[model samples]
Target: MCIYNNADPNSGIQSGGVYWAYGPHNLSNQFGNHFVMNNQYDGAWVELCTGYNGTGKGESIISAGYGFVEDLSPINSIALGTGNNYPCSPP
Candidate 1:
């Protein structure tokens, strides 16, 4: 996944890429709206969570090849992959 620092998709600059792996990658003080792109191949997906290590509330699912601009202030961590145990609903 490519995470952009800016919310505007047209001009958003990519902050970094998150590869597919078993994760709970924590965001360090990220705030405001940001652009997130899920570029994984196959049916891989990502989950944004409100707490660290894939815990907490307000989870969101992003499927492969999809993107969105959203307020990430409440999101503290991200998990990569697809499974039945994920807290968020399928996208």
Candidate 2:
């Protein structure tokens, strides 16, 4: 149940950069990944994430645009959903 909205410039996301979310599902304990709309635009910037997918509200920049995403990381973790936990990083 991870979703992102890029309607506002104050969304804290990189103006035109792609966003990615990685984490485990609440009840299923499944891992998943989410990428923002990969549209072509000038002066695009993207923000990196940890727990939940979707760029947060702060520190944005022009999107440089990344292409062809393929990762096997989630295959070993859990899928993402509304019950996902942000900041999944271990301290």
For TM-score, the strongest prediction is 1
Per-residue lDDT of model 1, residues 11-83, tens digit only: 6555554455666687777788888888886777778888887777745788889988867898888878755
| TM-scores of all candidate predictions against the true structure | 0.80, 0.24
Tell me the lDDT of model 2 at 60: 18
Candidate 1 local Cα displacement, residue 59, angstroms? 2.6
Pick the lDDT winner. 1
Residue lDDT tens for model 2, 9-35: 334333323224433322122223323
Worst 10 residues of 1 by lDDT: 82-91
Please identify model 1 stretches exceeding 4 Å from their true place. Answer: 10-17, 87-91
Clashes of each: 0, 14
